[model samples]
Target: MMADDGGCGRCCFSFVLTSGLSALFLWLSLRTYKPSLFIQDLYVPGLNSRNNHTIFFQLTLRNQMKDKGVGYANISLSFLYNSTLLVANHTLPAFYQGHAKTAHRKDSVNAAALPWPPSNGTVSFRVRAATRVRSKIMLWFTKSHALVVAADVEVGASGEKVKKKSIKLKSGVADPGSRWLRMGVANAMLFAVFIF
Candidate 1:
């Protein structure tokens, strides 16, 4: 009878331990927050003509997690004319963002001197930004998520401030290729953890 009671206690303890770990992992997964990117402003600072001009822009990053922060490994921004011609490109400096904080960065790019002027009064281009970010939840778990955001922007050669519009890109919508790959890898890791 004593042996039976001991076995029952061990089984109960095992069940409780497994349930607690599962609950903890589920909570962490649900609470994890992803960072977002937004283009605050874009305009031409000074230009005698459209031939040779410099474009200045402001970018903002908002961290959604209240207790977690993100560390950036690399960030690359590129501007393309008509989705083919590369107009300007800039590599932003690496930085860290605190939880629930917004970081604003100002950057400029000199448009390449074209042999011929643009036919229209406004030039349209796409802005593409790729970033590698590492997110940490409290002090326990850390994960890496890759984010790529792109938007079509038009600027008037007349130096008019581009219409004030907030262009914000979220993770899964902007770059599905990398997001899917990451999801697969994460699932594999989780399977390995739980199985082994």
Candidate 2:
């Protein structure tokens, strides 16, 4: 009877240990992990001015997850022109989150003179980032997100402004006929001249 009681006690101890391990594993699996966003590249095409400059905004985001589950990330970009502010583009990516791992991404944009007022052109701009932590979960594996970015800037005028002009002829010149008719007659005359 003593031996039988000892065996039963050992069995009960092992059962409690197994139950505790299972609960811990489940808790870790459902844990949530959040990430970040980044800008990668920026370029300017129509930039040309001495006092005006083109700016390229580059950004990057990095998130290391401690759990494995679906995660969401959002990044919003805004530019400050002189004293005014304008919202640029934004991006979002979703992936799995895991422990001791990182994920990354990037975005880029070129900012110049907008069509609004302030034509005198003392315009300057800067880029900023806003990030958030969405909900996360744990799974059989781990996932991560990392964001990266780079920007190229050029300062100067856009280019030479060309003015339209109206041409005037001497008053004694005869009026020319329709352009289509003149073109047809010229082509016919050229053909005749060449054939003859």
Candidate 3:
């Protein structure tokens, strides 16, 4: 019985030591890991100038971290109409926007999400995001004026600095009256067909 007791004690000691070593290794690995975030594709869709429509754009962000990340993501969008600055806030419905750290990616510390930008750049850098940033913008047609739209966004990680780039975009919506006229003609044709 005494020998058996001694053997069990040794086994327990080895188990505890192994557990401690494993924990230490994990801590070191996490500390040495550097998180990375970058932007993917960003562009605006085409629009007809004669159809009182809105211009829309999209952006993609990507997170290149092996482990999960815990941090905040702040994205800003600037819109321009014919070289005029439109919405300047980065937030929703404004020029300012931000997301909490709780919003992560794939159960990891990283987050690859999409947030809309206020404006797109014509020649500058595009909006930066994680591994996948898919954002959309809507520019309403208000007049029969020739306009140029541009947008840009800056992105950074927790320990990294923020970077900026302009996104060049060219789009125009058509006038509302023309759209109405076309719709009316289409409706008239349909009505005539139905009558016949």
Candidate 4:
């Protein structure tokens, strides 16, 4: 009876240790990161002119993950004037990006009702982008996650971005998927702790 009890205890310990290690690995593999976005160039042709109030923009999105890929759903871009008025909008089609891949999108939209610039010789605008992202692990893709980002842009009288450097867009609010990931990590850690 004593030998049998000792053997059962050893088996339980081995199972618990294995479970803890598996949980730790699962937590690590489930982590996800957001892709980086930058506004490479923004140009307004003949700023608010009658013939051409068109807004042209160049956007660069990079997937910096080393071991994972990113797939983007339809991305909606909105251009706002004075942060209050909508000047133009466009939709980018869905696409897939491999790890460390960079993608550039150049598009133009008509902003017929854009207002004139003030004495600052600069126009203030905001660009907002919304899209769903799927994280691709080794063999399967995670569920679609929502991501929203925006950037403040300043255009000079020359109808070009005031800054020559790329401007990064930041999300005003955290994505639900990110929150879920955090929760998942926390739970996994707790489970591992209990097992150990």
> Candidate 4 residues 3-72, lDDT tens each?
9999998998888778768876876767778897889999986664535778899989999888899999
TM-score to true structure, per model: 0.69, 0.36, 0.26, 0.83
Candidates 1 and 3 compared by TM-score, better number: 1
Comparing 2 with 3 on TM-score, the higher-scoring candidate is 2
lDDT per residue (tens digit) for residues 88-190 in model 1 = 8898988888878999989888877653334345655677888788776666446666778887776665554356777774443444334555775687568
Model 3 Cα lDDT, one tens digit per residue, 1-196: 9999999889976876676567556543433111222222322221112122222334322223334332222334443333333422232221211221122221111112223233232222332221112111122211222222233433222211133342333324343335655665676567546644
Question: In model 1, which runs have C-alpha deviations exceeding 4 angstroms?
Answer: 1-26, 29-31, 45-48, 115-120, 170-196
Which is the winner by lDDT between candidate 2 and candidate 3? 2
Q: Compared to the true structure, candidate 3 yields what TM-score?
A: 0.26
By summed lDDT, the worst window of 10 consecutive residues in model 2 runs over 161-170
TM-score of 1: 0.69
State the lDDT at 152 in candidate 3. Answer: 46
- By TM-score, the candidates rank as 4, 1, 2, 3
lDDT for model 1: 0.70
TM-score of 2: 0.36
Worst 10 residues of 1 by lDDT: 169-178
lDDT of 2 by residue, 137-184 (tens): 432333433322212121223321211221111122122223334665
